[model samples]
Target: MSRNAEHDHSLVMGLDFGTDSVRALVVDAATGEELAGEVAYYRRWSAGMYCDPAENRFRQHPLDYIEGMEAAVRGALAKLPPGAAARVVGIGVDTTGSTPAPVDVHGRPLALLPEFSENPNAMFILWKDHTAVEEAGEINHAARHWGGTDFTKYVGGVYSSEWFWAKILHVLRHDEDVRSAAFSWVEQCDWIPALLTGTEDPRRIKRSRCAAGHKAMWHEDWGGLPPEEFLVHIDPLLQGLPGRLYTATYTADKPAGRLTPAWAERLGLPPGIPVAVGAVDAHVGAVGGGITPGVLVKIMGTSTCDIMVVPKEKIGTKLISGICGQVDGSVIPGLIGLEAGQSAYGDVYAWFKELLSWPLKALLPESSLVNRETGEKLRRELEDDLLRRLSEEAAWIPAGSTGLLALDWLNGRRTPYADQTLKGAVVGLTLGSTAPKVFRALVEATAFGSKAINEHLMKEGLEIREVIALGGIARKNDFVMQVLADVLDMPIKVAAADQACALGAAMFGAVAAGLYPKVEEAQKKMGRGFSQAYTPDPEKAATYQNLYKDYLNLGKMLEAAWSSAGEATPLR
Candidate 1:
């Protein structure tokens, strides 16, 4: 196959490895037109299994990711033109952040080892895993006592249980086999490329600065990794791990390497096709959605990740506290990437649905016409119709009609106040309240949570000029988006593409192939999308503002109650 010139419209592939599945998109390098795409669900036995609440553990098999990758690539290729695969110039990958995999010296997962096959600690820790809450608390205490010299500043002021070190500490303290057998702790963002290329060198594995700085306690001012002395305070094993794990060369647009000959052939593509360093799904979604400087891109789904880019000039020496991370060139070159998020969004709806206790007969009234196999179908149909109707009815009840306010701490807060120990709460519910009213309260609560984050950003001099919303929830839930807009009193720009993260990864492929000079450049050229601006309604905004004040007062009251009673506060 002959290589096309830089301006030629060759095909580029962007593969997004999400928490549930891997999605791939083949796009035209010049026009950003999506030529083909595919999604492959993970087939692991314990794909979505969460460990005990006390431990906060979550695990996934490495084989599941590998299988999903292969399946997505094959599925995408099948939809492309017969000769397009050969013409593909580069590929890029993005994944859920803070997901860590324990690997041996050869980059193979420790779970694959005979001795550690059954050990869950040897498997990949999903980003949502909070098993290391205790360990994270210890790290936070140490960082504060250490006088801000630690690298924890990069990640809002405290290390999260969701990150690499905390999970590693949890496993090391609990699982002897995993601790003894693990040679390295790798980020999922880096591991995918390492697995494809079959290399274990620190130089070979492209660690995304977006993930490292945001989730692994890395800062450029302190030369990337945390100080050795600080790591020693947290855990003696992490002392020397920093030296081995540190990397200075962090650029999102740079090509990490080329596809290995074996992988290329297996996937029906040419060898030496450029592969860009991996990125966080939300960060890449910003690039893919064409959110440039001053724009906040909200990648909303199970959770919502708010991403923004700022020029180096705007970021003064003052460290912006209470955010996911601010890494230079992590999203676009010469810019700082800032991330904030809600730990729960759409999950709240799912949780409510699961808690609904409906009689089987009531849910399946047409049982005579529907067989046992189709009973589930009928139940789902009824449930969906009811939910939709409830949503519509809830919209008519007016803001604050329920005489209730809620704290969206169901899954804990991910930004501004990055606390995971908090629990959800609802106050002022009366006997007259219905399920739809409660549901509306929950939806409003999430919007208020977003408003809190936005307020914090504005206070910190990070002017959020516009919001670009993307992901499944943003597309499916108009009520949620409109409520959010009203609560924040800002226009919400929804992305046109349903799979913005996957498309964003594909944009990186265009940059790696030299089709564009930067990720943003590629986005402008090929990233297709229109923003649906939901102008805030003045009346609704006023009502929400009053309710938000009540919500804040409720938060304080709850905190005081928890303290006085010596009980844990609900809503982290």
Candidate 2:
């Protein structure tokens, strides 16, 4: 089929770079139809590549980003009908954050160079990496009394180890080679779009408001970023970094740049296709979940990110404290996107599943399950279908009947207090407790965390009129959704789009490409609808009220332990 340059409409491409894989989607820009899509797993990442889980160190090579992007985009494009590629006029991107990397003066991720090829210090720091725990604490300590203004005020009162500067500080402190070679740091979300458009010059690449405001402490009040004085106080190494970094942050509503000849040829696309500025996956997922004013959208995957948008006028003088951030035009062009979430949602559940199944493999021989065909089937059921079966049985158990409660902090807490040092806890466990019973308590703990976030938002003067759930857990697990509804006493709507994050990105692409005048217009026409709504049961809600109090008590006890351990009093 011959490519037609005149064909400027009907399709747009959206790329979402997640922790495990990168997903590419081709969508009907006018109708919000998901025409074709594919996911490309990072081959290196799948092999436990560049990661030290024991040390909470996770890194992704820039090669993984390039390879995943080309593979997924080509794979998705190949699935489309004839002439679909020519119809593509715009591209959008979203990625996990604050996944940042130290870069050369040319804006190339240091890991991309031959000298730094095998250096973990040169790689993009994964959002889950907690290698900067001490640096984050130091930042919090310094920012609290950083002379005139507290730079950490906008980002939940407490600085987190999982953010931009913290990881940079960690690398600077530990890796002398990296510190000497690195001129600046760049977020994954910001770098990808710039890379596609061949805007590798450090001063030319457009930075994303979604990433900068939420993770990098960029605000207009004191100019672009937290003053150099504040950063210097945290660490003298950060002296000239901010000046080398970014001054202005742009929202995704605008185009970062057009695709370059090299990237276009590599990805089989037109050279001039508009590329929208990058954003965090959850913020765009909010758009795909039909996010509007007062609607809370939860992107529940490995982690959970809660998103909501409100007008600037509606949030006049009141600061929505204790959130990831409130960034203007992050989700919508004319609104503010508020973010808050648990660091580990589905991750916490996955941890329990592994903990419960370890004995089944270690104590009993795997050969026993493989000996007979039926035994193999039983083993498969135990390994793969465990979560489903547990959830089913847990549904039968009454609220608080488990007599066991768990803290959903296996990784750490993200919002209400962004504490990365908190550990998980299980209380009232007896020999009689079964895996299913304990699983029920774990689910309740996650729901309770969501409730706390909602309460915090309300306390900060934001009214949540609606709740929308998106991502893998929200779609496949009806039991979890129902329980979440019961706990919050709020109706929850599951987004219809299978690739909601990518779809939201497509909406931004449409606007940036000039197919739509504004993001709201693009979203209104191209965004997916609701698939299902979960309503709270009155009885379950009442029972959860009492259980929530116990949860509070348990949380207080845990917080006290942190305090005794010499941590600062949490602001949650």
TM-score of each: 0.93, 0.95
lDDT of 1: 0.78
Candidate 2 has its poorest 10 consecutive residues by lDDT at 1-10
State how far residue 19 of model 2 sits from its true place (Å).
Answer: 1.4
Best by TM-score: 2
- Model 2: per-residue lDDT, tens digit, 1-572? 31221244568899999989999999988788999999999988889889998898999998998999999999999998876798888999999999999999899999989999999999999999998988888888887666778777777767788899899999999999999999889999999999999887777889999999988888888898988888888889899888898899999978999999999989988889999999999998888779999899999998999998989998875666668888888888789888899988998888888887786666555554355566556656787888898899999998878898788877877878788888778899899988888899999999998998998898888899999999999999888888999999999989999999999998888888888878887788887798889999999999998998888788878877763223444535
Best by lDDT: 2
Task: List lDDT for all candidates, in order.
Answer: 0.78, 0.87
Per-model C-alpha RMSD: 3.3, 3.0
Compose the digit string of candidate 1's lDDT tens values, residues 228-290: 788788778665666566566556577778889999977877798888888888898888887
Question: Between which residue pairs do clashes occur in model 2?
Answer: none
List where candidate 1 sits over 4 angstroms from the true fold: 1-7, 45-47, 50-55, 357-371, 383-387, 560-572
Q: What lDDT, from 0 to 1, does candidate 2 have?
A: 0.87
